[model samples]
Target: MASPVSSPKKNTRNRKLCTPPNHSLFFLSLLVSMITFFGISVLSFMPISLQDSYLLPLLSPSSEPFSSPSFSSAENRSQVTLASLALTFLDSEENEPILSNSVMVPLPAHGIVGSNVSEEEREFWRQPDGEGYRPCLDFSIGYRKASVRITEEKRRFLTVAVSGGLNQQRNGIVDAVVIARILEAALVVPVLVVNQIWRDKGEFSEIFDVKHFKRTLQADVRVVSSLPSTHLRSRQTIETMQMPSDVSPLWIRSRFLRKLNGDGVSILKLQGLYSRLSKNLPSDLQKLRCKVAFHALRYAAPIRELGNRLARRMRIEGPYIALHLRLEKDVWVRTACRTGLGAEYDDIISKIRGSQPEYLRASQNMSYLQRRLAGQCPLNSLEMARLLKALGAPRSARVYRAGGEPFGGKQALQPLVAEFPNLVTKDNLARDGELSQYSNRSSALAAIDYIVSLSSTVFVPSHGGNMGIAMQGHRAYVGHRKYIKPNKRSMLPLLEDTTISNAEFSRAMRKLHAKSQGQPEMRTNKRDRDVLAYPVPECMCKHSVNNDVSHH
Candidate 1:
């Protein structure tokens, strides 16, 4: 009844409903319509598969797939959504393969693997309206990986050599093989420098020192140039042999070779020296003997080779000491060779071990001897002496009585050097620089000079070869400054085991020399006795000898 009266309020309400919308509402309606239109347009423009599989389900709850999550409550739905989105993006071939193959492309910049990716690939993923797919983890797994690349390169090319005093015993080649494989260096060739050559060449014969030929023949080898002072320091005699036109023993001296090539000097000097040195030499001296210094040489060959390589590759900027391990075989052989003799090798070894207390040390700390003798029983006196010396003990300490009496339990004369500082100090190197080779004689001399300048001490073998290089290159001073741990005097173990007796050593050396040279009438007199009998004598004359031999 009241509505039928047509009151002003009722009339206004009806007018309001009937009238067109105000400007605000009109604009709002236009905006809302435009938004809806655009939404529909975007949905239509999507890929057929995307629209059917993703956009439609997202916009319309009716089309949303039902997931029967097994958990009691859907607490991590947001996390699930994010994971789902990641999976969806990666599912596409165009996206997943991009990241996988990225590692194969050559790195644009030289940086560690953990740093920056290629710029083009990075930009490709930064789209404004894209279905956001940014990788959260740094992923690198392929040829570029450090492990893979190193292995591949190692399989390419390599050669290894094991030589004893310039290709002697040939056993060191074993170590070369072992270390080469461990470093992943692909070595295709293995060379053995036989120690037998030295014996055949005679102790002091010209051809006995075949180091030059061996060293020049191949570049890849672990060569030992360490021999007795008698051999190394002795005046070198020469023998002539057929040579290639461009190659000559005279070329041993780098400076001389360059000068001769430059001035076209005749190689008559080398020919003359060779003829004089080789004249009337024994058949054994005509060829190199690989026995006398082979043990130490073979063992150290790899390390020396590695040292040279490291010097070249890493540009080492310091002096390096090549500490030879002559204590074991040398000591045992000497000790066992002279049983009742006053200068028994075992007694000497015992004295040497006593001088260097480390000889008596147990295998607790990780010294070379400890590592080698771990879980093994105690070593003999010679073995102990060798171990002590190898651990870098002082060599000046006394190992024998003044009047040739046996100091049975004397402490090591040398100080232990296991933890000695400055073993490889930069200050120790000579300011004179690297070795040069020109004439064979000069080159040999230069090599000696280089060794002397580089090393503070030269550990020589008892018989010979050490003297050859030492005397020629001024390295003889180095040997004199240090004690010579005689090889023949040390105790020797059984054939399979490393034990020794003084008497056994003398017999072994005599037999080794005779058997090696095929000379049944060969005899070593007081020279051998003097070498095997006494500790390396200190130089008394003022020959400018350096006597600053530190324990370490």
Candidate 2:
């Protein structure tokens, strides 16, 4: 061998000569090393300016490297620096990339860090816009119209005595509104007669806001708490007229108007007033019914405040369900549900049934299955619990019981409470003396229930009652939130069939109520007995452009 250093030079020359003068391979290797060195240097510096440009282009065969004359300028240098920094950032540990240019980069889905540009773009579309999704009634928009005050050509007043349970009274009030419009009479706010069954002693003003009620109906109908002092003094001049049990709009226009024309003030003592959906009423009057029921019939401030406070306390991050469990003492007796309670409770049911109305006495003669099919029996606590479970209501679901005490109180609710520990009641949420003032007062208590039920995420009524029907209609008019109307008629056979598996029962229940959830349209034909229960096509307006405009 030659001298050590001379020997290495001789070997390198020999290897180069043996490679057949491959200039392409030699230059390619040198270019790659230079590019790698440049990337390392750029990343080390990480200049703030190089935060948004496309860095991968530098490695692309089609694009020239940073050796271009344009990149030598100060502005171009900044752009190069930005692009380098952005690449470095993308390589580093950051959630989103900071690219100088809108370069499409492949990214992973799922997690934030590994997620790509395409996923981020998709997420941008998924995010909720400002104001969010408001599916309910916008009270602000509802009250935007200028107040409408009716000018009665004839100076006549109509004073009506309202009678019935909480719901009956409510229906009567709605009917009274329509009647007042037809007769063109100044309405005297009807009294809320004490419910004989529940023994409710609450007055109209005690539960509802008297001032708000009068002010709201001022435009549609002249409503007053009492007759004017001038009219009161002229008692003899005031002709007391009792409305017939089956009085029609035509009858009122013809015979009724003739009698009131000569009178100083006609006090129309009204009774058994309920919505007559078949009658071809004025469209304005129909809307007025909605205004009277929803807008005008607001609860007293104190009751509303209490209801809101209770709802807030009960609600977690999400909305709560208001289950109007109509399994009160009166309901059990009226429906004769004692047959299933065995002989131990037979005497109790018998005594309770004795106190019920003559109509309910006939229910005692019918079998449990017959009563259930007829929709006469209210769903018991156990049945309600099973139904809720089958409906896939989460275990942690916040349930607010809207009605009075169940038939068996805490004992009866144990099964439901065990399954859904978050279940609460007005009494449970409220302190002992907080709602004591309105204790035993059914109407006032119902008002509290109404406020809470109205604000609920979901409303499930065990049976059709005044509060249930009103709440259903109210929710429908508002953004049509989830109102689960259980098919009690069909549910009876399934619930009674103990042979069925839990999974099968749940599947059947879900299928039975598939259409009942969300926004369901009520039958508009003559078959619809309770048109006031779902006054959507007539009462509600589409809140947004995206909503179905067919009903509007």
Residue 282, candidate 1: Cα error in Å is: 22
Point out where model 1 deviates above 4 Å.
1-321, 324-454, 457-473, 476-480, 483-485, 493-552
Question: In model 1, how large is the Cα lDDT of residue 82?
Answer: 34
* Best of the candidates, lDDT: 2
Q: What's the lDDT of the predicted structure labeled candidate 2?
A: 0.61
- lDDT at residue 385 of model 1 (Cα atoms): 42
**C-alpha lDDT (0 to 100) for residue 193 of candidate 1:** 30
Relative to the true structure, candidate 2 reaches a TM of 0.68
Deviation in Å, model 2, residue 56 alpha carbon: 51
Give each model a TM-score.
Answer: 0.20, 0.68
Candidate 1 on 57-167: residue-level lDDT in tens? Answer: 232222111112222335334334433453454424332211111111110111112244344222211112101111111112321143244333311223333333432
Q: Which candidate comes out best when scored by TM-score?
A: 2
